[model samples]
Each structure stands twice: as structure tokens, then as C-alpha cells.
Target chain A: MPLMFDHVYYTYDASSPLPSKAIEDIHFTLNEPFFCGIIGQTGSGKSTLVQQINALLRPTQGKVIVGEFVVDSSKKKMKEIKSLRKYAGLVFQFAEYQLFEETVLKDVSFGPKNFKENEEVAVEKAKKALKKVGIPEEYFSKSPFELSGGEKRRVAIAGLLAMEPQILILDEPTAGLDPKGAQEILALFYDLYQNGTSILLITHDMNVVLKYCTSVMVLHQGKLLGMYSPLDVFYQKELLSEAEIDAPDLICLVEQMEKKGFSLNRQNIRDIESFVAEIKKMKGEVK
Target chain B: MKALPIGRYTNYDTFLNRLDARFKLLAMILFMVVVFIHFGSRAMDFTFYGLLMVMVLVFMRIAHIRIRQLLRAIKPMWFMMIFLLIINVLVVQTGEAFYIGDFPIHYDALFNTLYTFVRLILMLAFSLILTATTKPMDLTYALEWYLHPLTFIKVPVHIIAMVISLALRFIPTLLEEADRFMKAQASRGVDFENGKLREKVRAIISLIIPLFVSAIQRSTDLADAMEVRGYDPNGKRTRYRIMHFAKRDVLSLFFLLAFFGGMLALSICGIDFYAFIL
Candidate 1:
């Protein structure tokens, strides 16, 4: 099922006398098995936009449809809100804080148990998710707090993955991790995407976008500048500047090299290795 | 993720908003005491109370604050106020009793409860006005000024003032963090809304543990930031925004004193009180 946002507008504390718009006129759609990156400056409403996918926040003026579940102001008490969150699991920044169960296994099982799964079934799903996220079985019965920061993050992701969401939404999932840790986590997300789950990552890291994301949505002052394939987004320098989004270093370096008389024809090259290979080929041609 | 209405400040150059913070704080305290202690059941006392309420309403109007804001401030307290009224109405059984269904409603109990309730509401209204109109920094300075005498005993008054100001500053941050924690837990299927009493308590525990952990982490970061910025509680520091006593502040203080004095004299003479009609 394709996720769609229809002119979604949201105001924080709208009932108060002073209502400030968090997101406005946001429109986008994503089909299954796509890895999408949402990039924006701070306070540009990236977090607010991704949150609507799970009905954690309802739109003030429009609608957000995740699969068959629709989130609008009128759906405040809709029976599908719980299911919507389950289907589109949102892992917040510092999600490790959400773990309160005595054991990591129980913590990961919380989501499935909440969805009415029996104890044995939920435990089985939790175990599979834990293993999938690369957590060792010995740590299953240990306290989440006792684990290192990276381990805690994996456990947190396992908790959401156990829910078996069709679309996984994460806000700055690699915010506080080291480079290796971040790479490992992003690899996990890529694996999940290859397994048929669509992913929406809210991040400001352009490197992650160019590397893992298939398409990117650029937000500026609560408005969508454009949503395009990752390479296409980088080529739109004017639009990227308007959104204050920086293109990946490799893309900028390639553009600079092209300006310096290097005739490179490779398109949509995302990684450093591919761009270097293209540059080496141009050097060989010159020789 | 901003939750909790602890009354944010509004910038308005109105008579109340422009009053000297120290004078306003003192006048509010005295006014509350007079309203509570001298509220006799005479005709004149009721008239004075009515006039006091009218003055407050006029002040709010001049300050550009709507009645809805006042009502919103009182919204959370409605449950407690109603509980108080019902419990008092049912528990006290002296004086003339009337049957509203099987419960005995006593005249004296009802009168006393109503009197206290009005006092409580008025007290809350004045506090709301104070918080809504005055900036928190001004309040912190006013508190520092009022507590300056404690320095005679070598109580580290500056440090105390710094702590109070920092606490006030973190109120909004902690509230926002708590809101985020609640939402994060909710996403994990922790049912915060509907559950049995035991289950609800367990859910609350889930929320509090995360909130407490985040609070500690935030405080550590804040302290480091303060240290980096050369903030020393015992160090001598100069004020950036000096307090000034303007003409409007003097006028406000004069009016509050005169109003309370007039009420006192009228209550002594006993003119038209006895809870006046409505």
C-alpha cells in the first residue's frame, strides 16, 4: 500500500490563543519497499511530518493515509489509530528511554503484546527481531540499561521491528552513535527495506541520504520544496539551497571536478567508490 | 511537545504589566490576605468583594487578556474545586438541611463551602494574572530583592536567587521533555488513556522512569553549559536589565492600597454584604 499525505497541515497547540503552524500544505506519496529520507533544517517540521504517518500527531487541516488508516482531526477516537501506529512504527530519537521492562526480551515484546499477540508468539517475534538487529541471545535476559549505547539503540529498534510494521519511521536514529555504530544501524535499516518494509528516515545527515535513501523529500519552512530521487535532488542546487539542504560531499566534489574540465558521464552515482572510479576512468582517457 | 499550562508570560504595556514587580508581588499578597480574612457575611463585605472582582476584570481587559484565558487557567482545577464542594456538601451535617435526593444539603455547610470556593477561585485568578502579565525573570529578581535580608545570616542569597532563576528557566524544558517521553511510550503501545487502576499505575511508572532519566541527563548538560559560560553562583555579577519604578507602577500601588483600605473601612461600617445576590 502506498502512503499518502494530502495537503497535510498541523499547528502545535492549536486550541490555545496563539497557534503556530508546524507543517503546512505538505503533500507526498510513497509506494512500498522505498527508502525515503526527509531532510530539513531545525524547526522546519521534518519531525512533525514523519509523525503524522503513525497518527502520533493528526493533521490540523488535511489528511494522512498510511495504508488504509486515515489520520485527521475527526479521527481522534478512531479504532484504527492503534493499528496505524503498529503498521507504521515510529522510533523516536533516544528511543532507548522507552525501554522500561526488566529484561530486553520483555521490552522488545511490549509492542507485539500491545497488539494482542500471545506471550509465546510475541516472544518468538521478539527473539527473531533481536537476532535480526544483531543482538546476541545472551543479552536477551539482560537489562537494557546495562548495555552500551549502540546496543541500547539496537534493542530499541528491535522493539519496533517486532511489531512487524509495513512502514518503519525513525527520527535521527543515528544521532548520538559513533561512525561505525551509525553504519551498522543504517545497514540494519537497508536490510529491513530489502525485506519489503518501506522506510522513512528523518535525518539531517546528507551522507546517509545519498548512501541509503532511494528518494528524498526536502522541506523548507513547513513546505515541501520537492521530492525526487536522491541523485535528482542533488542536481537541483537551487532547490537544495532554498531548503538549506547541503548536497552530499561526493556530489559537490564531482560537480567541482566537472567545472575543472573532467568529462564525467556517470549519472546518479551515490557513493565515494563509484565517483572515484568515474574520476579514474576520466584520468585514463586524458592519459 | 509543549504541554502543561503553567501560565506563560505575554508582552503587553498595560498598567498591570508595567507595574513594578516587587510592588505588584507585595500588593497581591496583601490583597489575598484581606479578601480571605475580612470577608464577613455582611452586605458591605459582599459589595466590596464584587467591586474587587470587577476591578480585576477591568484590569484583565486593559491588559488585553481575554476571559477565555482566565477560564483556561481554571480548567484543570475544576475537578478539584468540584470535589471540594461535593465532599463538603455531603460531609458536614449541621444547620438547616434539605434533601437533594438522599443526600442532606446543609445551609451553613453550603454557605461556608461557597465562600471558600470563591476565595480559592479569586486567589487563583490573581496568581494567573501575575504569572501571565509578569516575565519570569522579573519575578526572579523580585524574589531576590525580597529575600535579600537573608544575607544578614550569611545564607548565600545570590546562590539561592541563581537556583530559583535556573529552576524557573528549566520548567518549560522539563515539561517539553516529559511530553516527548509520554509520546515515545505511547508509540510503543503503552496504553496511557484507558486501563484498569493497576495497569494504569504500571503505565505511569513506564513514563516516569524515562522522564526521570532524561531529566538527569538534561540537568548535567545544562550545568556544563553554565560552567562553560562562566556562571559561578558565588561570583559577583552585574545586572543587564535593571528594575525601574515608573509612574504607572506608583499609581498601581496607590490604587491597590486605597482599594484595600476602603474595603476595610466599609466592612467595619457594615453596609451591604451577606454574599450580595449572585
Candidate 2:
């Protein structure tokens, strides 16, 4: 089902004397499966926005609609909150810490079992997910706590993947991972996105957005600035600075090259490989 | 998460806020002792206790603690207070009894319940005042000073103080971490709110294990950072902010001492000041 946020707002400690608005009037809709990147500075409400998708945090005002499930502030308790969570798997930041099961396989199977999948089916889904994330069969029986940091993170992601959620939301999943591990994790998500699962990634890295995201949402001070295509977002230098986000290095390099009297096509140049190919084509045309 | 009423130090410029932390801690203990002093059957004893309760409220006002904070401080104990009232009314059936649909509510039971309830509220309010006025580091220093005598017997007061300060320091951090862990597990479809008793227990285990793992991880990181910064718990440490009792503190202590002595004497002699007035 299409995911939609109809003028959603979230306030921390709404009943307290000192209430803080975390996100304000956030409106968005995803009609189809797509890789979307949510970029914001710290305390800019990116995490708060994604949390409403799975009903982990109900909006203080307005409603979040995920397929058939609805979480509205007016409702005291939403009967379909658990089902909504099953549809949208959220991989938290530092998810490795959440690994508490005795074995890696059992840890990954925890999510599916929670959603009421039988023992054999849960283990099967968990094993498939672990393999998809590239964890070895040998590590399945080992204690999750004994695994390396990267392995633990993969197993955590595998835990979510076992549930086979339609919409996969990750909050800075690559945070604290080494560069190679981060890229591998991002590529894994990209593969899932290609396989038809909608991906919503919250990240501070502009490069990841440029490389993987089809569309980008910029949040500033608890408000949605706008959602634009990756190229459109990078093209607006003023908006980037306004949101306190740096343009990806590739974009900056392309801008510098264009400034020096070189007429190069910037529309399709998303990564270093494409930029290099564009330069080569330009050199040939000049000759 | 609801704001915890205790240990929430509000920054305000007032006599109690500026009072030495040592004196504030000592005053809190003395106030609690006075609150627990047994009252006789005379109305004068109850009247004196009521006056002491009023004095605590006055101190709370002087410290700039708002009425909202006082209510919040007492909010968590409300269920216990009601339970206490019910138990007292049921068990202490003495004096004149008023029947309410076959349930005999004794006059003495009501009086005893009121006394205990008032005492609890006064104790909580005064402690809240002490905590709200005193800075945490200063409180730790005061605690170290209190435990100074233990150092003579080879107890490491400095280490104990350091441990208390560190625990206080990480309270917020741990709370934030716990919130994060709860959300994470909730996202995984661990239904914490609506579940059978067995399922709820399992959900809590899920939340708790993650919290415990992360807490241990944080403590290790903290220990490493402290070691890197040359924190030797057993080593002698120089004081930065030394506390000195001011004239106001000395005067307040004398007033408290005189009040305690008068109340003690009245209780011992069974004097009925209200009866004399009548």
C-alpha cells in the first residue's frame, strides 16, 4: 500500500509543561517502490519522521497512513499498530546493540517469530536473510555477541529482513561502520530496493543520497523544506546551504569544471564513474 | 518520557538555591526526622505537626519551586497514598465509627491516615526542594564530606564520591538509551503495550537485554575515557568549588534545632497547647 503522511506533527512530552516539537506538518506520499533519502542536520526531525511510519511514535497532530493501517492522534489506541510494524521494518542506528539472542540465527529469527511465523518458517526466513546479507552459515550457530561489529550489524539488519517488510526504513544504518562496511551495507539495501522493496534511508551523508537515492527529502528545523530528485536537490546550491548540507564532492567537482569554460552535461552525472566518462567524452569532442 | 521530579535541579536565584549543599542535605535529614516524630492523642500534637508541614511548603515556595513541580513530585505516590488510606481504614477500627453501607470507618483510622499522608507529602516536598536547589556535583561533595569519617577506617571516600557522581552523570544518558532501545524493539513488532502476561514479560526481556548490553558497552567506553584522562579513583584530588556555611545557613540550623527541641519537649511532657488555648 502507498505510504502517506498527511500534515503530520510530533511533539516530545506533549503532556509535559515543557513540550518540544520534533517534526512539524510533514506531508509526503510514496506511490510506488523507490529508494528515498531523508537528509537533515542533527535535531532536524528526520528520525522522528521515519518513526511514525511503523507506529513506533504516533503523531501528536495529524495522521500517518501506511497501506491499510492508520495511526491518528485522535485515536487512543490503534488496533493495527502491530500489523503496521510488520509491514515496515525499521533498522535503528547502532542496531548491533539490539542483538540479544543466544545465536546469530536465533537473533535474526526473532523478528519473524514476533510477527507469528512458525518456528521452521521463521528459521528459514532468517537463514535466507542472513545469506542475502552475506553472513556465513558457520556464524549462524555462534553467539551474536561474539561476532565482530560489522557481523553484528549485518545480523541485526538480517533480523529486520527476515520479516520481509514492504517498506524498509533505516536510520543511519551505516553510522560507526568502516568505509568498506558502510558501502557494502548500502549496496545491500540498494539490491533490496531493486528487488521492489521501498527504501527510506535517513542519513547525513550527501554522497550516499547522490549515489543511491532516486529522490531526496530535505528537512530543516522540524519542517520539510521540499522533496526533489537527487540531481534537482544538488543543483540548488542555495537550498543545500540553507539546509546546512554540503553538496556531494562529485557535484562540487562538476560545478568547478563547468566554471572553467567547459560545456559538460551535468544532468546524468551522478557518480565518479559517470563524471569521469563525461570528461573523457568532452576531451574527445574538443579534439 | 515523563520528567522525573526528583534530582531535577532547577536554576533559580533564591536563599535555598544558594544555600550550601552540605547544609541543605543536613537540613533535609533533620526535616525528615521531625516529620517522623510520633504525635500523642492531643490536638496540640497534631496541630504542631500540621505547622511543620506548612513550614516545608513555605521552604518549597522560597526555593522558587512551582506548584506544578510539587504536584508532579507527589503524582507517582498517589496510588500508594490511596492504598495506605484504605488499609488504615480497614485495620485501625477504633474510636467513634461512622458506618458507610456496613463499612465502619473509625475516626482514629481517618486521623492516622491523614497524619501518615501529610508526613509523606512533606517528606517528598522537602527532599524535592533539597534536590532542586542543590547542584549534583555539590551534592556529591557533600556526600563525600559526610562519609569523611569512613576514610579514617580506610574506606575510599573519594572513590565512593566518584562512583556516585558518575552514576548521577549517566542517568540522562542511560534514560535516552533506554528510550532508543524500546523504540527499536517496538519497531520489530514486539508489542509492549497490548499483550498477554507471558508475551508482555517476553517483550520486557527483549527491551531489558538490549538496554543491559548497551549499558555495559557505555560503561566500558566511559572507563576507557576516564583512564585515558588520568582519573585515579584512589589518588588525592584537589577541590575546585569549596563550600562554606554562610550566616543564613548557621541561623537556619539554629532555628531548626530550637524547633526540634521544642517539639521533643512537648512530646515528652504530653503538653496540650491547644487545650490551654481553649
Best by TM-score: 1
Candidate 1: Cα lDDT at A238: 89
Over the stretch B1-278, how does candidate 2's per-residue lDDT look in tens digits? 54586847878889988888888888888778877776554476567667876787788778877768778778888898889888998899679999999889998888887887778778878888888889888999999999999999999888989999999988888888888888888888888888799999988988888888888888999999999999888887898877898999899888878877877776777777666677
lDDT of 1 by residue, B180-241 (tens): 87788778777788878986887898888877877787889989999999988888789999
TM-scores for the candidates: 0.92, 0.91
- What value does DockQ give for candidate 1? 0.63
On DockQ, the leading prediction is 2
Candidate 1 lDDT, tens digit per residue, A109-149? 98898888999999999999999888999999999879988
Worst 10 residues of 2 chain A by lDDT: A74-83
Report the lDDT of model 1 for residue A106: 93
Which predicted model would earn the best lDDT? 2
Which parts of model 1 are misplaced by more than 4 Å?
A276-287, B1-5, B42-45, B100-104, B228-230, B266-278
Instruction: Write one digit per residue (lDDT tens) for candidate 2, span A172-258.
Output: 999888899899889999999999999999998888999899998999999999999998899797898899989988888888878
